[model samples]
Target: MANDGLSAGAAARRLGVAVTTLRTWHQRYGLGPSRHEPGHHRRYTVEDMVRLQVMQRLTAQGVSPAEAAAWARRAPSDASLSGGSPDASGGSPELTAADLAGFPSAAPHPGASGRSGVSSDVAGGSADPVDSVPAARVGDGEGGAPADLAGGAPADLAGATPAGLVGSAPAGGGQTIPLGPRANPAARGLARAAMRLDGPSMRYIIEAAVTGRGVILAWIHVIMPVLIGIGERYEATARFIEVEHLLSRTVTEVLAAVPRPPRDREPRTLLAAADEEQHTLPLEALAAALAEQGVPTRLLGARVPSQALLDAVNRTGPVVVVLWSQLPGSGSIDQLERIQAVPHPPLILAAAGPGWPVEGLPPTVTTLGDLASAVRLIARATSD
Candidate 1:
């Protein structure tokens, strides 16, 4: 047997499937690691990885696991994997098409463990944390999660599949969230993490994106999609509130992890969730994005009663105040009216979040659109 191979966790992340899925594939499909050495656990050879990739793609495309496995088991010996025969539906191919294209062939066999800090030993597989997902990428990728594998696969990170599948039984509710189609791998990975309530993996993927892509890009491409998707899941089933809370808390922590501007500089930007509106993740992203540009802002997180907001406004006398309301009817319009009533009203009173009304607002309040727009507007406003 050739020496290059990956542990179950490393293999799972590479394939973008859960470890249990991997275990199921190994046990039921006979696709387990074929390479074994004197001292270590059975490792997945490059060929083994190729097989798992096939399994993940087929299953993800809605093929029954049993049939997909049968195809996977024969892959090592099948030259048809290169030039695949298409199924009757024409939506999918008979072989793992990803295996035939630049994908499977492009992935280097694990010659020297996968990533910088991970080891490839897995005599007994390591614990999986929410099918540990790699960071989502945000530029010029052209397809679904698996199809985008060539562009977005972080083949080295050691992420194991969570015990439960992503969106399937998230937090053991047995409620499967339809993830729709993911063009962003990070969004796909983040959603999987949220479903598992996998805090560590969620943190890892988010921080990686923020640090590499900057806060705004990360929020728009990576964070918001997952949050919005999860919110929709909650809307449909009224379940996975636990998933939401964990996800929100994890997002808060990661965004907060973004370094703040120097305290010596007085904060001109004021951010707050609207009165009686507790959703503040967007504001958190805004704050972090602003901080990335070295602009300082005072964040008065979560719900702030109208009077309390006025008191803060009066004391700080900020130049810009961004009030966030997630949904309509959850926030009071009186808050904006009171801020307008203040003697030293901010130079720019921005109404952010979807909760704000599009029409009939005091002309003083500017409606902030998306995160990138908010960052640009606020960052520019703060400079002057």
Candidate 2:
């Protein structure tokens, strides 16, 4: 086909790379379609852009330009890029534990199974595996709570479990709603309480919980905010350990029941950490949502070294890296700057909680307090 279509600049923009780099790939690697234009300026076709995009993903995955070019040469046809491949182009179908970085599971799409490695249950093995919410309303931990909320004490959920509901709705209930923003006051309260938590303590609760929708929401909204409030209260004046302990134990149970989402196409490799000089709860909430959205995620937890983060990015090539700081210190700012310098940086750098003193963080760097905001951000990015 003739290549007298898209301009070099447009093609570069679509490929998320510079025009010069595209030109270099075209020249040195024999990539790109034949370029031609009535005005004699190079014009790349949609095919050229598609090839470039495939090359970009391959290169991001650590493939060399030459090897990426070779792979792109055999990539999907141009037709596949136009509203095809499940949730837009170049999106992964399977989200790993690492992809669960900033939001609930993304909506399902036909192409969600495009890539491999996602568990068979998530891929399409059996919808029943995902339908396993307990029949009884599990305690929110406001009353006489047990020690093992999600740590495999059968007694906790045993009463709620029914033999017939194993692969579908509970005996008397309906279908499970996808984990998302709920207008329920309970969800809002959870979000509010979590906003007060620092990240580390919050993460301890989430990572330790079982995977289910209810558990996921409680962790994102309730436990997270409560912890933040406790941290703030501690900063102001000493507080009783009983209050913190109650909050932690209660929230930990909620997270243990939330199930990871089926499959999503968002990039895997999620990163969350307490900012160099900050707390970690906001990041923990973000990570939980990411898991629900089906993005594979990994939380480095509190006090990660800037060098360690950079190395992780280079080694893992995660699609997004989230940095949460309830209180941003000079060290946090310095580390943030260093991360921004990494090549082809993660899709987002987010902060939440408090004390972000920087004047102008990048547009992609966002600060959020609740699960709703994180869900929307990841959902939009995944669809795009």
Candidate 3:
């Protein structure tokens, strides 16, 4: 930075974000350059840069822009100017992807141990209070009223269901997706948000989960359960497809919003959905998880016909290709066969998602069982 300070373009480059994004933060959130000289454009001083970095990091982790800005504005000047130590109101230290990777696969239910202190109150209490309460454990056997995860007082879900959803349910019951007793509080909160079709609250909860827990944990513990419950509801009642669509769309947006590796780093990994397969949320989660690990990927969302995928493979020459399938109709072995027979095949061709048949898979193809394993395998292959 010059003594005068850095121009908006320079600051955006240093932050790896768009100039327009910076301008929006300035206009909407009041996070802008403070240094100005006579008859000269305002420039970002080191202190301003530090604030912007804090804003950028928080928002990237899934914090709402307004809340993130509030924290950014409060960042201490003594904090590292190189985007280190946000220290916003004495929050927990940021967890890197490596740090999150060591977390146990089975996260304790929020009620098992009191809710983790990491606050989920980003929605400013506008979202239903029930969502903030910890979920009840399934087999506690001490049958009593449901207790709030935070305060250990009784809580109710009867009123949480929105009026609009009442008619959407079958005659047998009111609007509710049956998340079994074992569901975590985050997952339960997500289910309620989905039922209400509240996009902003849904994004906040999902993003907070991703930021606090890694993408893999967020998907497994928070997202995947809600999706499964919704799918079951749709199967039984043959309704609430709108809820499913909206939730899926929100998850897609959040995962896509996860920051990618810098533009300078060429992506060596490719991800795609099989032909006619519309379910790509898992792949999106995989892509975001990889990005957290500093690996760039080319995500060809939704359905990809065999030739187009091959064309992409040939053009990009990616070292690793992951093909996802969510149903049997889309899982064609010939796609894998064609990719393997390419003039110069990728080092790893992975068959991910439940769509692939357990038998008759090509020996050269790797099958990914879950998000964490997929990240580890592809990240390793790309690094190699």
Per lDDT, the best of the predicted structures is: 3
**Runs in model 1 with CA error above 4 Å?**
1-182
lDDT of 3 by residue, 220-245 (tens): 55665455445444444455556666
TM-score of 2: 0.40
lDDT of 3 at 127: 18
Scored by TM-score, the top model is 1
Superposed by TM-score, candidate 3 places the C-alpha of residue 253 at a distance from the truth, in angstroms, of 1.3
- Per-residue lDDT tens digits for candidate 2, residues 249-326, read 444344333455554643454544544532343344455556666654666766677788888877777665666443
Candidate order by lDDT, highest to lowest? 3, 1, 2
In lDDT terms, how accurate is model 3?
0.60
TM-score of each: 0.59, 0.40, 0.58
Model 1 has an lDDT value of 0.55
Model 1 is weakest, by summed lDDT over 10 consecutive residues, at: 115-124
Per-residue lDDT of 161 in model 3: 17
Instruction: State the lDDT at 154 in candidate 3.
Output: 7
Cα displacement (angstroms), candidate 3, residue 111, comes to 26
Output the better candidate (1/2) by lDDT. Answer: 1
Pairs that collide in candidate 1 are: 18-161, 19-161, 41-123, 131-161, 131-162, 136-186
